[model samples]
Structures are given as C-alpha cells and as structure tokens.
Target: MELQLALDLVNISEAKEVVAEVAEFIDIVEIGTPVVINEGLHAVKAIKEAFPHLRVLADLKIMDAGGYEVMKASEAGADIITVLGVSDDSTIKGAVAEALKQGKQVMVDMINVKDIEGRAREIDAFGVDYICVHSGYDHQAEGKNSFEELAAIKRVVKNAKTAVAGGIKLETLPEVIQANPDLVIVGGGITGQSDKKAAAAQMQQWVKQA
Candidate 1:
C-alpha cells in the first residue's frame, strides 16, 4: 500500500512547506481539486518541480475531454490524473489511452457514483491504474464515508488497484489499513493537524506496518 498526502487547502508555497516536512513518509503528493482550482495546473508543476522523487497526482476529476485533460496534466508533470467515475466510458477510455501514451496513469474517482461495484468492474476493463472510492467534502459534511464502497470495489475490480479517500485521519488509519486498499489518501486528516510532520509520520508508519 501507498500513502498519498492531499494538499487541498494550501497554496503552492504552503503545499511545499508541508511536503518538505513529511516528504520522506509519503509516496505520492496530491495537487487536490481545490488547489488545482486555485492555482491551476501550475500547482502540479510547482510541486513536481520541488519534489521530483515524489509522485504527483493531479485531481482533475475530469468529466469530459479526458484525453486532452490527461495530456495537459501529464505535460504539467503529473504522474497520475483523475477522471470522474460517473463520466461516459468513452471519456474513461480516452483518458486511459492518453495516459498510456504519456507513460502516466489514470485514477478514476468514484465520488458520487451510486453503483460503485458495477461501475468499478466496467472501469477496470478499461485498464485504469486505480479506482478510488472517495467522499467529497460535501458528502463528508453530511456524515458520509466510502469505507463500504471501498470493499465493494475491491470485490470486483480485477484490473485496477483500489484506493480510498475522504477525511481519513491518524485515529481512523488503522481501520482503513485493514481494508487493504492499494492506496490510502488523506487531506485534512494530516493537513489540519497542529503538528503536520508528526501526524504524517505516524500515518506513514501505520501504513507501512500494515
């Protein structure tokens, strides 16, 4: 399993500061949807330029023109780009094909999809790198999570690795680890902490031990 640090609320400089503290503990640095919205793909370019070793994931949550978006993010030095699971199969295929040509990856975010398992099976057929079960900030506000959805995707997604994200914290990392997701994503769980380094260190340790 790998641990990904999501930089949603931070700007490029703040994102760098946080990564500098916990870079050793994380395998991937995520330029979250919010960060991308705020700083554009320049955020991805900046982070990747700063930490060349750490993989950078651009959370585009793309719904259309997948090929073009993936190409743009890849050009920005994004190792992986995201597409919405609710998007059409043609979009998913375009993204995957573009990613393959660019030697990058596509992670399909199943944030609002209703039938996760079914959709995961279909997406897996397209050879996506990862199928992520995610609960956006709005759903998290209503007290929703994607733990069960993670399990559902794990059951039928044979071609793609599985990932889980949404409000994951040090206190809840153990449960997520037990689910055995291929990748574990956390945003406020670590970024919102008083001691970001310590929080990231502990979560990294736990993910490694698992």
Candidate 2:
C-alpha cells in the first residue's frame, strides 16, 4: 500500500509547505480538484518541480475531452490524472490511451457512480491504472464513506489497482488498510491536525505496517 496526501484546500505555496513536512513519508502528492481549479495546472507543475521525488497527481476529475486533458496535465508534469467513472467508455478509453502514450497513469474516480461494482468492472477492463472509490465532500457531509464501496470494488476489480479516499483519519485508517487498497488518500485527516508532520508520519507508519 502507498500513502497519497491530498492537498485539496491549499494554494500553491501552502501546498508546497504542507508537502515539505510529509514528503519523505508520502509516495504521492495529489494536487486536488479544488486546488487545480483555483491555481490551475501551474499548481501541478510547481508541486512536481518542487518535489521531484514524489509522484504528483492532478485531480482533473476529468469528465470530457479525456485525451486532450490528460495530455495537457501530463505536459504540466502530472504523473497521474483522474477521470470520472461516470464518463463515457470512449472518454475513459481516450484518457487511458493518452496516459499510456505519455507513460503516465489514469485513475478513474468512482465518486458518484451509482453502480460502482458494475462500472468499476467495466472501467477495469478499459486498462485504467487505478480505480478509486471516493466520497465527495457533500456525501461525506451526509455521513457517507467509501469503505463499503472500496470493499465492493476490491471484490470485483481484477486488472486495475484499487484506491480509497475521503475523510480518512488516523483513527479510521487501520480499517481502510485492512481492506488493502493500493493507495490510501487522506486530506483533512493530516492537514486539519495541529502537527501535520507527526500526523502524516503516524499514518505512513500504519500504512507501512498494513
């Protein structure tokens, strides 16, 4: 398993400072959708340039023009880009094809997909690098989580690696690790803590042990 820190609510400079504290412990640094929307792919470029050792994921949550978007993000130094699971198969295929050409990766985000297991299986066949089970902020606000969804995907997904995200804190991480996701994404869990470095170190240790 790998630890991916999601820099959602931060600007470019803040993102850099946060990653600096936990970069050594993290395998990937996600320039989240909000950050990308606010700061543009320049956020991806700046973060990747600053932390050359860590894999940088641009959360485009791409819904259209998959090939062109992936190409643009890859050019901006994104190692991985996200496309919505609910997008058309052709769009997903386009994203994966472009990612392959660029030698990068595409993670299909199953955020609001109603048929996660069915769609995950379908997307898995499309050769996406990772199939992520995610809960957006709104759903999380309604007390929903991706744990059950993660398990559902784990049971059905064959080809693609699996990932889980949203509201994953230290107290809840062990449960997530037990599910054995390929990647575990945490946002406010670390960023909201008073000691970001210590929080990240502890989370990384748990993930390593699992």
Candidate 3:
C-alpha cells in the first residue's frame, strides 16, 4: 500500500513546509480540490517543483472537458489527475486518453457514484490508472465512510489500481489497510496533528506493514 498525504486546506507555502516534513514517508502528495481551487494549478506546479522526487496529484474532480483538463494539469506537472466517476463515459475515456498521451495518470473518483461496483468495473475498462472510493466532507460529517465502498470496488475492479479516501486517521488506517487498497489517502489525519512528521511516519509504517 502507498500512503498519500492530501494537502487540502493549506496555502502553497504551508503545503511545501508540511510536505518537506513528511516527504520521505509519502509516495504521493495530493494538491487537493480546495487547494487547487484556492491557488490554482500553480499549487500543483509549485509542489512538484519543490519536491521533484515525489509524485504529485491534482484533485481536479473533473466533471467535464476531461481531455483538456488532463492536458493542462499534466503540463502543470501533475503526475495524476482526477475525474468524477459519475461523469459520462466519453469524459472518462477522454481524460484517460489525454493522460496516456502525457505519460501521466487519471484517477476516477467514485465519490457520489451510486453504483460503485458496476461503475468501477466500467471505468476500469476505460483504462483509468486508479479507481478511488471516496466520501466527501459532507458525507463524512454524516458519519459515512468509504471502507465498505472500497471493498466493493476491490471485488469488482479488474484493470485499475484501487484507492480509498475520506477521513482516514491513524486509529482507523489499519481497517483501511485490511481492505488492501493500492493507495491510502489521509488529509486531516496527518495535517491536524500536533507533530505532523511523526504522525505521517507512523501512518507510513502502518501502510507499509499493511
């Protein structure tokens, strides 16, 4: 399993500082939707420029103009870009095609997709690099999680690597690891900690063991 640190609420400088602290522990540094919205793809560019060794993901959650968006993000140095699972199949395929052309990747985020298993199977067939099971902040506030959803995708997805995200914490990470997701995304779990580096190190150890 690979550990991904989601930098959602931080500014460009803060994101850089936090990643510098835990860079060795993480495989991917996610410039989250909010960060991208706030700082634009400049956030992706800056992070990748600063940490050239680590993979950077731009969480576009793209719902339209898939090919163009993927191309733009890839040009901005994003190693992987995201598209909504609920988007049209053409959109997903467009994103994947662009990503392939750019030598990057597309992660289909199954946040609000109702038929996760069925949709994941379809998206997997579309050649997405990763099919992510995610619960947004709103759903997480209602005590919803992607654990079960992750399992559902794992059971059905054949071609794509599986990822899980949504309020994952140190205590709950083992549970997520039990499901064997290819990527485990953690945001507040590491960012909200008093000692971010130690927290990330511990989480990385757990994921490595898992």
Tens digits of per-residue lDDT for model 2, 1-210: 999999999999999999998898899999999999999999999999999999999999999999999999999999999999999999999999999999999999999999998999899999999999999999999999999999999999999999999999999999999999999999999999999999999999999888
lDDT of each: 0.95, 0.96, 0.96
TM-score of 3: 0.99
Residue pairs whose backbone atoms clash in candidate 2: none
lDDT of 1: 0.95
**Tens digits of lDDT, candidate 1, 1-210:** 899999999999999999999999899999999999999999999999999999999999999999999999999999999999999999999999999999999999998999888899999999999999998999999999898998899899998999999999888889999999999999999899999899999998988988
Query: Which pairs in model 3 have colliding backbones?
Result: none
Mind giving the per-residue lDDT tens digits that candidate 3 earns over 81-167?
999999999999999999999999999999999988889988989989999999899999999999999999989998899999999
On lDDT, the stronger of 1 and 3 is: 3
What TM-score should be assigned to candidate 2?
0.99
Query: Can you give the TM-score per candidate against the true fold?
Result: 0.99, 0.99, 0.99
Q: Which segments of model 1 are wrong by more than 4 Å?
A: none
Measured by TM-score, how close is model 1 to the native structure?
A: 0.99
